[model samples]
Target: MIDKQEQSLNVKMYINGEWRESSNIQKRSIINPANGSIIGYSEEATIEDAREAIKAAREAFDSGVWSNLSTGERAEFLFKIADKIIENREELARLETLDNGKPYREAEADVDDAAACFRYYAGLITKPSGQTYDVPAPIQAMVIREPIGVCGLIVPWNYPLLMGVWKIAPALAAGNTIVFKPSEVTPVTSKKLLEIFEEVELPKGVANMVLGAGSIVGNEIVENKDVDKISFTGGTVTGKHIMRTAADTVKKVSLELGGKSPNIIFADADFETAVDYALFGIYAGSGQICAAGSRILVEESIHDRFVEKFVDRANQIIVGPGSDLESEMGPLVSEEHLNKVLSYIELGKKEGAALAAGGSRLTENGLDKGYFVAPTVFVDVRQDMRIVREEIFGPVAVIQKFKNEQEAIKLANDSEYGLAGGVFTQDGAKGLRVVKKLRAGITWVNTYHFTFNEAPWGGYKQSGFGRGLGTFGLEEFQEVKQININLEVEPIGWFK
Candidate 1:
């Protein structure tokens, strides 16, 4: 439905509440990863642009333009922003699909999630409780929570606008100004989102967007001393770099990193439901999801049987262009990611794991031009192999067998990641019992990668610090300030 007019679009960088063409102007072609076509283009930002953003955010924070607003006022702005997002949901979804190459339905859901995130944070703005304390000896104390300060929000290409809303919303709700940087690969969606705020009447510089690669503009945001808080969501390697870079300023930091989640199948599981959720887990985003259930652990008793049904069910999936409404699986985000996934599939073969149904890239259907990878499943996989051990963000699922509860728990926790995992079982007590022992942050019983707004989402260990999407999310924005009050108005004789 998109015509040439939509395809030949220019995405401008947003700064200080104004659309600004980059001064150090270099344009980057943003391609549709699914079809390998240039969908849109954006002006790349430089260090000078980053400096301006930091200054704008710092000025907005120090001037009390955004931070000093009453909680109710902030809440109103957030609510208005959510409304504005709703108004532009269709346009935003189109931009997301064009730039990120996700199905319109999937992208629309992300847009909905983005809107919900703002509302969730809007409700929380008025809820951060400052406690009044009682103490003996004519002394009283109170503790207050205050925004950390100007925030530099760095989001990944996979889910640009959603991640932006997640990081920026809570920071704003807790009374902080932000300079948001969406990834170079998918910059237009966030840029398109900034347009919604035009009528929302947000304070200038309170919410800003800068575009560029992570090496330059993103680096500037992290290393700048003026930026007080750094909220980052990306791969663990880049996350570590952000942590190290932020340490120079000792800026408050929160990270949501990568995952190699385990999907465990017990003997009592409803195979029909488990298989359905499992396919959604591994193939929904062409396995590009950070929390994709790449490692599937099945009990030895049902291992063979489940693999057969899983393959049969998986084969029914339609793989084609993301724009195709009926298509179940699309290409990996880019050629690089496609090659990386193919390497993992090839490794599984070399390591002697049996390929149940799919193992290589697809080129048979009338769709040979796109960067598509077939939905792949490998059986009899071991924990030591690269395909099993590493986070392969692709449509490949590795099936391994476990004998008992002890081994299931062991295999699930064996990975270096403690991000997320799924345990499928009919027995709630047994599922909770096993999940409690598993080391991942978000555990789903009878489900895999479905995240909710009410629950806090984050990982343990190297999976990274901080939680998103709940009351715990508000805690990340604030630093505790304790105040002491002398309740005894009667002057102490010594003090008098």
Candidate 2:
């Protein structure tokens, strides 16, 4: 059931902390995943509108109005933004569920996570320090951390508000202005957030939003010379394009991109726990998460038993409307994404991987309307299969068998992506030892999807670089400045 709490909020792009209609002022229907109804529409942003957002953010940054604020003062405002998010969690969560086609509880939890991110960075900025060192007998050198200036933040649709918070909070905490673009598929929750600070808000151009496709607004934002830094989280191809666009001006860039993460099960592992972890990693968030554990590497001894348990749990996943709350899996972000994920299913079968269960869309259960795909499991998949090496980005798991710990590590490390992975074992020591060899940014022991506000998050290899959370994440927004002063009243020039 679509909640009545989803108020009819038709919002436009928020530029310069002011909500304004695009000159195009056009709106596109946002589908309700429950029954695929047109629930709401968002005002589309044009290239001109994107330019305006960039101009505003650049103006705010160059003027040093927001950037020059004291770290303590900036931290206070950051907390104020966090407080605003906490105050409206329910309404904002509801908006998130409607736009992103995710379960309400998870959406609500993401909103809470979003709030915690801001609060964490709010406290973190106050602790940022620069080095004070002796330069000579008469001179001392002091280094200060300064804001990097205007930031261009491009977020993905899978976790709209969460991704937004991940980038926005740290950018603001580091005393940088921002020009952000939320994915067009899910802008409702983002818009509701803009409305949170109607009365007391950040400096006028401190935070701004542009709405449009990546081909349009994103290109404008990332390529603009006024934009000092570009932070993006999306597919690898798009991230590469963003990086290339930033090259002209040599703007600072950070990208958290694609993943084909592996979930490895050792023969010495706890079977039940491994099964649960493997199931959740591939199926949670409807397998829309960038870190979704898509590859399953099992030891040869327990491969049969593990696949049985994993397939059983995967079979039980209920594919229905995200509004149902009880539904364990929801639709893909859009029809195109659904088709793309579906096409991979066909390829998996053709590549000689055995389809264990749920090979097609859920046209049964009167769910012929929404973009619903059945939770799928492919067994006896070779390491060479496309299903084993690629990111399906759907509720599909490909099971591959390995002979020993060494083989498991080699097979897991064979992928082009290394965002996240998990290891299961009964011996705690062995589990810790194997995680060190996995070559992934985040490693889980006896579980999957373990995340927190304090831990840094990013990926290795094709997965992209620069952490998105924790102290390291915030540091990405700053530039180091060193100052040298001559204590001796004598002039110092080139050792003269």
lDDT scores for all predictions? 0.85, 0.85
Q: Where does the lowest 10-residue lDDT sum fall in candidate 2?
A: 1-10
How do all models score by TM-score?
0.96, 0.97
Tens digit of lDDT per residue, candidate 2, span 62-118? Answer: 898888888889888878878888888877887787777888878889989998998
- For model 2 the TM-score comes to 0.97
- The alpha-carbon root-mean-square deviation between model 1 and the true structure, to one decimal in Å, is 1.8
- Tens-place lDDT per residue, model 1, 31-146, is 77766777767888989998998898899899999888999999998899898888888888877777777777888899999999999889877875989877775778889999
Model 2, runs deviating above 4 Å: 5-7, 493-496
The deviation in Å at residue 178 for candidate 2 is: 0.4
Give model 1's TM-score versus the native structure.
Answer: 0.96
Residue pairs whose backbone atoms clash in candidate 1: none
